[model samples]
Target: MKKKTKIIISVVAFVVAAIVTTGYIIISGMQKNLDNLKSIESNDVDLSKISDGTYSGSYKVLPISVEVSVTVKDHKITAIDLLKHDNGKGKAAETIINDVIKADSLKVDAVTGATYSSKVILLAIEDALSIATETNNK
Candidate 1:
């Protein structure tokens, strides 16, 4: 009976340790993604110069990623097309282009159920806009 009790305790401890380690890894990964999102916000590419031609932008967020191409003419956005999107149940994020077209800016709100994907899509669009603005500047 003594030996059996010791074995059970050890097994429980091992299982608890495994669970804790897994949780830690998951939390750390989540933090890193959050940090990346913060970095995107800081890039601060001016949208005013986004004129003419088509530009592409992409951003990866672990299980999901976004690739968007935007067309602009005379400083107005003509179209927004999804070159690639690894969205998971985030069909709402697909409307990023339409929202930007309606607002004429990236300050629009994210879709309720697909907030993360929406932000990522917006970030990709921001990246495309950055490139477009840079090219126009040159």
Candidate 2:
């Protein structure tokens, strides 16, 4: 082929390859994230031994971070409040609170579209639970 034709074809090929490679990387990264989430096992927490106080917990999912306050009363979780969440326009994930209170644990399914945020929030709650468990043991 001519020099000009060869150069043009090469440029087009490079663009296509770049696009495909970027797509693959994005997909693989997302799958890996989901795998990480799935690997996070739930702990069997006994809240009946905790005191009446608020415990704070936090978890970060890269671009997002969530902080929460867990209030225990008479060894039961009486309330849970989100103190802060650096969500990138994904406010709907806050609904996880209802599930938390209902389950009285952080082992509930994450929201459909907000799975990452949900997992992070639950993990934060788990942090609080861990503290409660540790304190109860002491």
Candidate 3:
């Protein structure tokens, strides 16, 4: 084979390998995130045990992540503010926060077409409330 031809072939092979490796890593990460979502279980917070204040928490699943502050007042969940939300095609999931506040629980149903985002958001909320309860108990 000619030297130039050999160099071209090597370059093409390297490019193909790099692309394949990147694709594999991305796919694996996404699968891991999906698995994490599937395993998610929102913990219930005892509002009565939590002090009246704002608490913050976060949850991340590769491409999706959420950070939220939960407000407690009079032993009730008064509001939830999303500090940060990174989602892909899951912008609609933001509305689920209102539902959660209205329901006063994290057991609310996920938004359509944004289940993973919804789960992460709920998990973050659960963590925030859990922290509040823990701090008040301490």
Candidate 4:
């Protein structure tokens, strides 16, 4: 009976260890992706160079990601739509879109306590605008 109990305990320990190791690996990878996103530099959009149109962009950073569509009209950012935002405890960041539209720039401050989500959202906007510029130049 003691032998059987010990075998069961050993198997349970092994299973637990495997699960823990896998979880740790996934978490670490996610952290790396987050750090990379945090390190990204955002630049202001040059609306003057971009033709009036809607531009779509997306940025992903593990637990957080954002997709945005920006509308430009007469050399101004007229509207912004957040098509998708996958955030963890960063719902407040969604409000940043309004700030962007009001300010007509990505220079607006990030949402407090949701800094990562804020940056991702801004980056997505920048990406969309940048693509517009690229497309125009081509």
TM-scores for every predicted model = 0.70, 0.70, 0.92, 0.92
The TM-score ranking, best first, is 3, 4, 1, 2
Give the Cα-based TM-score of candidate 3 against the true structure: 0.92
lDDT of 2 by residue, 7-111 (tens): 999999999999999999987886676678767765647777677789988887556688999998876677889998887555777898888888777778778
lDDT of each: 0.80, 0.81, 0.90, 0.92
Provide the lowest-lDDT 10-residue window in model 1. 38-47
2 or 3, which is superior by lDDT? 3
| Residue 136 local lDDT, model 2 | 71
Give me the displacement of residue 119 in model 4, in angstroms. Answer: 0.1
Off by over 4 Å in 2: 1-35
lDDT by residue for model 1 (1-138), tens:
999999999999999999999999987997688567655551445556666788998888865698988887777777889988886687787876698888767888778888778888888888898877778779
Q: Write the per-residue lDDT of candidate 3 for residues 12-94, one digit (tens) a residue.
A: 99999999999999989898878878877887777879888999999989888899999999988899999999988889999
Where model 1 places Cα greater than 4 Å from the true spot, the runs are 1-28, 31-48
Give residue 39's lDDT in candidate 1 (0 to 100).
53
List candidate 4 segments past 4 Å from native.
Answer: none
lDDT of 4 by residue, 23-74 (tens): 9999999889888877787799888899999999998888998999999999
lDDT of 1: 0.80
Error of 4 at 78 (Å): 1.0
